[model samples]
Target: MRAKAVRMYGTRDLRLEEFELPEIRDDEILAKIYSDSICMSTYKLVEQGKKHKRAPQNMDTHPVIVGHEFAGVIVKVGKKWQDQFQPGMRFAQQPALNYKGSLASPGYSYEWYGGDTTYCIFPHETMELGALMPFDGDSFYKASLGEPMSCCIGGYHAMYHTNKQNYDHEMGTKRGGNILIAGGCGPMGLGSVSYGLVCDYHPRRIVVTDVDDAKIERAKEVVSPEYAAEHGVELIYANTAKMDDPRQGLMDLTQGHGYDDVFVMVPIPSVCQLAGSVLAFDGCLNFFSGPTDKNFSASMNMYDLHYTSTHLMGTTGGNNDDLIEANQLAASGRLDPSVMITHVGGIDSIAETTLNLPKIKGGKKLAYTQFDMPMTAIEDFAKLGKSDPFFAKLDQCCRDHKGLWNPEAERMLFEHKGVKVEV
Candidate 1:
């Protein structure tokens, strides 16, 4: 079948093109992608193309599709998995298919298996490794957001605190413990806050620090302090960018006791240092950022590491179980990952939106593969609605739901007059 896809040709080079897909093998599955969440990792991959661990070297010759956090319906089922996954069933993708410990993942490694496309094939390896999850969520956006949510869940699960007496490591964040998310208020950080609020491991206090006050305000508005109180969690959004001593100010939030779990959300040396310096005894630090640089390093308090039993670890993506939990939480309405979406676009916007992702403000830039709309911020919907009836309806849907992108808005997007997109 022929499909339109955003293909990465080289570093900083992406193009939207229509191409024919080879017939699926007996063990592979074919799917039609609907919604794909633009990720920072895709930005890094595009910036470092061949040098990226997951990017193939010969991109000029064999361009790979450029997305991962995506969801849609199954179009064709392979012979082997007919009983498990049927055509017309909804599904979400876990891109980190660590098959045989290879760095190759979907969105970064595949030619026709990524999410930024109208149609793609799921390799037999995907089925064998269980990276393709079948979900019946309310909207495709929720399933797309699940992939990023699972990343946060993995970081949460990887958090470990050591026993002072036995020196044993306990997995998962400490219940009723102080948690800090450094460089938070971004997309993944918002996911962290959402998961922390809903997860069984209740944090006594969750402090989020970001450089941008606007982003902090937006985070507070979406995941409000009032909502946190309802969940028996103290949520605080702090602007540490202007602070002379960020570590001290962050520690002061915990009453100088420091935090039990510190999550580094951004790939900056200063944030890493800040996250490390404010850890309490037996504190677990999970570096959640994936930097493009090979030798990225940051100074840390070694005394705390050696004597204070401070644990440090990093997770790139989540496992199948983590994805399952994210889907379950989202499906049950305990977690609303839509707060991460700030912009909406179509297949035409993938290349430009992805290339300038860092410069673009706000959270996840979601794209519908079959649409032909420009990248427009959700916040701009009301302003755009003044002239266009389409934006007016979408804006109303968002306003009805506390200015959030919901399933109703997603349905309205497709039903909008004269906005039909075709490849």
Candidate 2:
């Protein structure tokens, strides 16, 4: 059997190619992928090429499929797995695989199933134990969002302030506690927003900061007023580039104090510095995004950290339990991650999409192997040059606030077309 997949040949080089299906082992299950979402990590890997040491040995040698977040229907289950999995059942698979005695899967590797393909053969180890969730949901797109949401759940489990008195009470008062999500416009940031809204120790106010106007607009749209009212949380969009002091904006929002919980969704050096600087006394700063280069470093006041009793931690990938909880969250309509999905294309579009990832903005891009849509290569889209109205406005905003717009801020402003001028 031949299946379609986006095969990466080298750094910044990928192609949609056909490959013969491998024979299914006795305990394996074959799934027909319905939807797969692009991951920022994938983009980074393609850019690094051979420098990405974690790429599977054989995968680096041969053309490899390049996606990890996806959902599908179990089409064929091998003999021993047939009873547990049935044909035509909606499901999502956890792509992480850990051959290392450790419990979690490596963040970058092809042994881990890649979702950017037509069909997938899930090994029993992951399918039986990881974040694979059963979904009888409306669409494959919705089911496909499970992996990303599960990653958010994992982040929540790893560091979120729980309602348990031991946790919240020890930190501080829970009622008026504030949570700040920096770089809150990307897919992971949006996931954090959804999870933060539903947390038991829900912050009195959830401050979402992003330089992108479009992302802020979309964030506002997804976090409807009704949801905000019921949850007792207020979503604030801040243009980091415009604010004289980004940390000051957060402090003012929390009434001169900083946030009790701060999640840094982007691993940019400046964002890390901001997170470390603004975290409240006894606050917890969770770094959700993994840093790309080893040279990247952020400056912080060690004395402040020592005196405040604050905690700083980082987590990657999630466990099966997180995926299960994510599935429940979506099924109950408490969190609709599908709102973050904006574009969907077939396997043929993966190469182009990956290449243009840095330029695309607003929402998550999805790739599907089984369905074909009016797909256009992102490269074909005309670049919004400096002469464009939005670009001009963005440049002016950055120029006016010279100190505020860091590299991350500049990228967000460009990607989201968010330029706020005084009326």
Best by TM-score: 1
Q: Compose the digit string of candidate 1's lDDT tens values, residues 129-231.
A: 9888888678999999999999999999989887857957788999999999988898899999999998889999999998888888899999999999999
- Misplaced by over 4 Å in model 1 are 242-244, 417-423
TM-score between model 2 and native: 0.81
Put down candidate 2 lDDT per residue, 230-269, tens digits, no spaces: 7877877677878888878768888888887888888788
lDDT (C-alpha, whole model) for all candidates = 0.90, 0.68
Report RMSD (Å) for each prediction in the order shown: 1.9, 10.1
Q: Lowest-scoring 10 consecutive residues by lDDT in candidate 2?
A: 401-410
Off by over 4 Å in 2: 102-113, 128-131, 160-176, 374-423
Q: TM-score of each candidate?
A: 0.97, 0.81
